[model samples]
Target: MLKPQRPLKLLIIDDSPDFQLLIKTYLEDFGIVCLFATDVVQATSTAVREQPNLILLDIGLPGGGGLLLLERLRANLRTAKVPVIVITAQTTDGLESKARFQGAEEFLHKPVEKDVLIDTLRRVLSRPPTQQA
Candidate 1:
């Protein structure tokens, strides 16, 4: 008999260690396996290697930032359709619009409500390809 597969794998790219810890703790019980990257380079590498089902990206990353990473990921066929949720504090001056235009599935502001985050992830992951956000 085969073992049960996990529901989802999630990658979080953020510079704040405390925030990372908080998210990890908040999401672990929901059956999401969380992976962390403090910078764009590591995030990109992890995204390719881990092939997470979803990505929570922070806009203010070091070296390249989340938008740059989103561009790179969209250009790569292997990771292009993976649902990305932009979780950032910088939701100013069309930043959210830019993220949406860059192909992020959803843009979530920081200090994210736990229920909203989980619900958004669940909805995105549950949809079929044509319906995915």
Candidate 2:
């Protein structure tokens, strides 16, 4: 008999407890298992250890910022190819471009719209991992 598949795992790297709870609720509605990391150190360690299917990263995180963490994630072979969707409250010019340049599969604004978030997650998960140069 074929083995049962595991639930999809999504690592959420953000410093806000309220946002975490909110996002978790949204993702749980779709049957996704959520993991949390509130800082860059924890984020890297958890990501390396858990090997989540996807990552939702917040750009304003304390301890090193999300852009730096994104670079580190891309540099590490274990986490490099895991799709990242950057979620940020910041509206700074070029922030989205920067995240995209760093390998984020999608960029989302804060006060995340439930439908859009879910749709983006599904779309990103459905595609094959792009071969990194």
Candidate 2 residue-wise lDDT, 11-74, digit = tens = 9999999999999988765677899999999999999999999899999988899999999999
| Candidate 1 global lDDT | 0.85
TM-score of candidate 1 relative to the true fold: 0.91
Q: RMSD to the native, candidate 2?
A: 3.3
Error of 2 at 105 (Å): 0.5
Q: Best candidate, lDDT-wise?
A: 2
Candidate lDDT scores, in order, read: 0.85, 0.89
| Highest TM-score model number | 2
Residue 31 in candidate 1 has what lDDT?
Answer: 70
**Candidate 1 clash pair list:** none
What's the true lDDT of residue 39 in model 2? 98
Candidate 2 contains a number of clashing pairs equal to 0
